[model samples]
Target chain A: MKYGIVVFPSKTLQDLANSYRKRYDPHYALIPPHLTLQEAFETDIDADKLTNIISEIAKKYEPFQLEVHKVSSFQPINNTIYFKVKMNDVLQNLHEDFQQQLPCEESKHPFVPHVTIAQKLSNDEHSDVYGSLRMLGVEHSEVVDRFHLVYQLENGSWTVYETFRLGKD
Target chain B: MKYGIVVFPSKTLQDLANSYRKRYDPHYALIPPHLTLQEAFETDIDADKLTNIISEIAKKYEPFQLEVHKVSSFQPINNTIYFKVKMNDVLQNLHEDFQQQLPCEESKHPFVPHVTIAQKLSNDEHSDVYGSLRMLGVEHSEVVDRFHLVYQLENGSWTVYETFRLGKD
Candidate 1:
C-alpha cells in the first residue's frame, strides 16, 4: 500500500490555506491542507508493524509550536506557493525521526516544512499570485500535538489510517 | 528509573471506581484509577530509545471497547477486589505486545486486565465488600484510544511521562 505521514494544521490555518488553494492549487480536493512530514511512499510492509513503529515515534515528543509567518514561493526551483512554516529544533527532530525510522526512501527535497497553497502554475500566473500573496503576508501559529498516517484511496483522495498524539500521558 | 504503562479510564468510570476506592483501596491516592498494561519495572535503557519503541507500538492498533461489567474479587489469591474488565482480542494483544517488546520482567501473575477498586483487604473484609459490590453490580463501557508511559515521582504519585495514541498515522 502507499502511505505518507503529515500534520494537518488547525482549522483556522486550513481555512486560510484553502482560501488561496481554491483558485491556485489543483490538489486542493485530493488532500487536506497539511505540512508533509514524510512524502508519500510505497511500502509492502505489514500494516500492523508499520503502525507500531509510528506509534512509538509519536510518544517520545511533546507538542510543539508551529508558526506560519509569511507567504513564500518556490519560484526559481518550481512554481509552488506555500505558507512558510518557521523551522525549530523540535520540528526538525520530528522530521528527521520520521525519515530515519520509516521504511521509505529519503526525500529528494530538503526538509522544508510547509503548507503548500498553490502549485503547478504557469510563470505569469505564479508571479501574479506569489507577488500579491507575499505583499499581503500571513501570520498564524498554533501548537501541534498530533500527526497522521494517511493512505491514498482508489479514488486518489487521501484518508487518514491512523492518528498519533504527541507528548507524555 | 522505574516505569509502567497504563490506560486511564474515562472520568465517568474513574469516578465510579474512586467511590469504592475511597473506602477500600489503600493505594487510591498514589495514582488514578487505571488498567495496568505493564507493571512498574526498573530500567536502565535510554529514555529516548524507550520512547521510540513505545511510539511504534501505539500506532499498530485502533481504539477498542472496554466493558467493565461487575465487581469481582480474587479470593484465596490475594483479596484484590476490582471492576472486572471483559477480555477482548485487542486488549489481550496490547498486553502481550508490551510484554514482548518492553525491557521488563515477566509478570508473575496471568494477565487479568482490571481497575482495582480495593486491595489488601483482610479475608473477612474482602468477602464482605466483594459480596456487597457484586450484588450492586457496576456496568460501564468506553472506547479507549490511548495509553501512557508513566513514572513515579519522588512524592510517590505516578505521573505521565508520555501518552501514545493508538492506531495509524
Candidate 2:
C-alpha cells in the first residue's frame, strides 16, 4: 500500500488552507489540510513493524508548536504554491525522526517542509491566483500533538490507518 | 551557565577527528572529539528544568547508528574543514529537538550537522592542511546511544554536567 504521514493544523488554519486548496488545487478533494512528514511510499513492511518503529520514535518527542506565516511557491520548477512552515526545532526533529525509519529516496533538493496551497496551474492561472492570494498574507499557528499513518485507496482519497500521539504516556 | 549539547563518536572515530584537529585546529585543547548538537549558550533556566526537558525528549528515541564520512570545507564563509556527519532521522531529530528548548543566537546558518576537523588556519596554513588532509579521507561509523549536556569551565575545557541515555525506560 502507498502510505504517508502527516499532522493537521488548527481548525482556523485548516479552514484557511482548505479555501486555497479548493480554489487552486486539483487534488483538494483527495486529501485534507496537513503538514506532511513522509511523502507517499510503497511498502509491504508488516503493520507491526511500522507500528513498532513509529511508536518508538513518537515517544521521544513532546508536542511542539508549528507556525505557518509565509506564502511561497515552487516557481520555475513547478507551478505549485505552498505555505512556508516556520520550522522550530520540534517540527524539524519530528520530520527527521520519521525519515530515519523510512528512508525515502533523496530528492534533488533538501526537503522544504510545507503545506501545498495550489498546484497544476498554467502561467496565467498561477499569476491570477497569486495576485489574489497576496491579500491573504498567510498566518496561523497551532500545537502539534499527533500524526497519522495514512494509506491511499484505489479512488485516490487517503484514509488515516493509524494515529500516533507525540510523547503520550 | 554556558552549556552545550553533543554526542561523542566511537573511540576509533574520536581518534581520527582528534588527529586532524591536533594538526590544524587551534581550539583542539578546548574541546574534544564530538558532534555538536547545540553550541554553547548561557541560560538561567534551572538545572532541574534543563534535566527534566532533556529527559523527556531522550526517552522517545532508540539508539541509532551515525556515519561520519567525506572531508569537506565551509570555505569563503567559515574557512573550516570538517567531516560531514551523515544524519539519519535519529541524529537530525535529536539536534532539532534540542533547538526548540535552547535556541542559540550565534548560529547564523541552518545546522549542517558536521564534526570540525580543522579550523582557524591562515590562508597558507589552510592550503597546506587541506592538501595533506585529502589523503586521510574520513570514514567512521558507530551506534549513538547517549548524549551529554555539558558546561564550560573557567579554563575553557568542557565537562559533562549531565548525561542523558537514549531510549531509557
Candidate 1 residue spans exceeding 4 A from truth = A1-169
Candidate 2: CAPRI quality band: incorrect
**Top candidate, metric DockQ:** 1
DockQ of 1: 0.02
lDDT of 1 at B19: 82
lDDT of 1 by residue, A44-111 (tens): 88655887888788788889999989999887989999999999877788888888988889888889
True contacts kept of each: 0.00, 0.00
Residue B155, candidate 2: C-alpha displacement in angstroms: 64
- lDDT of each candidate versus the true structure: 0.81, 0.73
Candidate 2 chain B: minimum summed lDDT over ten consecutive residues — where?
B153-162
